[model samples]
Target: MAIEKIMGTETELGISAKDPRGFDPVSGSILLINAHRPIAEVKSIWDYTGENPLLDARGFEVSGERERPSQQDNRTINKLLRNGGRLYVDGAHPEYSTPECTNARDVVCYEKAGERIFELCLASANLSLPERQQIFIYKNNSDGKGNSYGHHENYLVDRRVPFDQIVQGLAPFLVTRLIFAGAGKVGVENGGERCDFQISQRADFFETFIGLDTMAKRPIINTRDEPHAD
Candidate 1:
C-alpha cells in the first residue's frame, strides 16, 4: 500500500524598516514576530532537541555547527499560533510554517492566514515605533537584489522509496512547473539572462542540481532530511 502524503508550507517573509540610518532585517524580523499575540499563553518553548539539519537524505551527515539560539533570543523570536502554525524569524526574514495538512486547500488556507497574521503584527510593531522607523513586510520570495529567501513546500513521502529515484522523478516536474506556477518577477538578478521580466522569482538563483545549502549555491532538490516527526 502507498503511504499517505502529508503536506505543508514554510514561508520566509521579506522584512524592511523605513529608517534613515538604514535597516537591519534581523532586528525587524525579531520585532515583527514578537508583536503577535498568541491565542493562549505561551507556556512551552519550541523544542529543538531532535532537529539536525546536517543529516542528509543521501545517507550522510555534513559537518557544521547547528544553530541553537539562546533561550532569551528564542523566546523573543518565536510565536506559536492558534491555527496550529508557527511564526518565527528565519535568518533575516520573519517566517511562518503551517501545520501539516492532508490536502492542498488547507495548505493554501493556512498560508493566507499567515499573511494576515503578519499584517496584524506589522500594525502592532509600528505602533511602538516612530512613524519614520515603521516596519514593512512582503510576501514575495526575493528582495529584488541578489538575495533570495524561501517559500518551501513539504511533503511526507514513503521512506521505502529510493532517494535518487525520487529526485529523478521530481526534478522534471519542478523545473517545468514554473511555466504555469511562477509568481512572476519584474527583473532578473544573479547575472543571468537580461530579461525585462521573468516567470519565476527564484529561477536565477538556482546553481546546483542537488545540495543541502539553502542560503548559497541553492539546489533544485534540497537533501536536508530533518523530518520534524518520527
Candidate 2:
C-alpha cells in the first residue's frame, strides 16, 4: 500500500515590547496580529466536540483534563486567513499555522507567506505605537533565559502504520537530521552550557527521551497522536 502525506507548519513567534520598564508579550502579540486587519476576522469558534489530546498512538487513552474554551476566549486570538493559514496568539507569542499542503514544496511557500504576513503586521503595529514602545519579534525559539518557544511541524501519516515502527524508523532520522535542518543558535541553555555556535537552537533543550511536554521537558519526537481532519 502506498502512503499519502499532507504537511503543514506552525510557528510561535517570539515577541516583546521594547519598553524596559513595562514589557508585555501578550499585549505585544495581540497588537502584532491585529495590525493585520484581515486576520482580525479570526474570531471563529473552534469545535472541540470529539477532540482528545491525551489519546496515545498505542491504542490507549490517558486520563487528563481537557477543557474546551468558549467562543469569546478563542475568538480573541484566532484568525483564519484567506490563504487558508491561521494567525493568532498562543499564550504570550504570536503564532501562525499554515494551511494543509499536500507536499513539502507547497508547505514551504505557505510558511514563507506566513512570515510575510507577520512582517506586514509588525510594520503596521509599530506605526501606532510610541517611538520607544516598539515591538520586536524573533523567528528563533528560546529567549536565552530558560524560556522556550516552539516551531512545530505537523504531517499526515497513515494510521495503518504501527506506532512502534513509526517511532523506530523516524526517531533516528529526526535526531541526525538537525545537522542540516537546524536554524543555528548562539550560546546555549537548559544546563548553562556555552557554545560559540550550534547547528540547532533546540538540540540542548531535549531533557527527556520520550515525553509529551513541549515546553518543560522537551521531547525529540512527540507521541501525542491526533488524527487530523478525522
Candidate 3:
C-alpha cells in the first residue's frame, strides 16, 4: 500500500505601508509579524541548526551565504503558533507556513486560519500607526511589478523513489493543472510575452527545466532538498 502523504503550504504575503514618508516593506513585514500574539506561549526563536538551503539535491552545494539574522531580529521576525504553524518574515513579505496535514481538507482549513491570523495581526499593528500610515497585507503572490513571491507547497515523498521519476510524474501535472488551479493574474510579468491577463501568477517566472534558485531564474522542478525532517 502507498504511504499516506503529509502535506503543507508556505505563503509569502505582499505587504506595504501607506506612509507619506515612503514605504519599507521589510520593516512593515517585521512589524506585522511581531504584533501577533499566539494563544499558547511558545518560543518564537526558530532552530536552524540542521537547515542547509545551499545543499542541492543534485549532490552539490550552491554558492550563497546562509542567512544569519541577529537574535533580536529573529525574535522580532519569527513566531510559533499554538496550532503548530509558523509565522515569519521572508524577504520583504510576511509569510505563514501551515502545519503538516494528512489531507487536503485540513490544509484548506489551516490556510484559512492563517488568513484570519494575518487579519488579527494587521489590526494589532495598525493600532500603533496613524490611519494614513497603516500597513496593508495582500494574499496575492505578485505585486504587479517585476517581483514575484512564493506560495510553495510541500509534500512528503518516499526518499526511495527516484528523483527523475518523481519529476517526470509531477512536472506534467503541475504544468497542466495551472489551467484550473491558477489564481489568475491581470497582467504579465518577468519579461513574459505581452498578455493582458494570465492564469498562474508564477507561470511567467519559470525560466529553466530544473534548478535550485527560487528567487531568480526559477525552475520547473526545483532541486532544493531540505526536507525539514529526518
- Local distance difference test, per candidate? 0.88, 0.81, 0.88
lDDT of candidate model 1 versus the reference = 0.88
TM-score of each: 0.96, 0.90, 0.95
Off by over 4 Å in 1: none
In model 3, which runs have C-alpha deviations exceeding 4 angstroms?
none
- Order the candidate numbers by lDDT, best to worst: 3, 1, 2
Best by TM-score: 1
Per-residue lDDT of model 1, residues 1-230, tens digit only: 77777999999988777773778888888888888976676666777778898999999999999878788877888887778889998888899999999999999999999989988989999999998899878888888878898899999987788999999999999999999999999888888677999999998899999999988899999999998767
Evaluate model 2: give its lDDT.
0.81
- Listing every candidate in turn, what is its Cα RMSD in Å to the true structure after a full C-alpha superposition? 1.3, 2.2, 1.5
| Stretch of 10 with least lDDT, candidate 1 | 37-46
Supply candidate 3's per-residue lDDT for 77.
83
Which pairs of residues collide in model 1? none
- In the range 18-73, model 3's lDDT, one tens digit per residue, is 86378888889988988897766786588877777898887789888887878887
Rank the models by TM-score, top first.
1, 3, 2
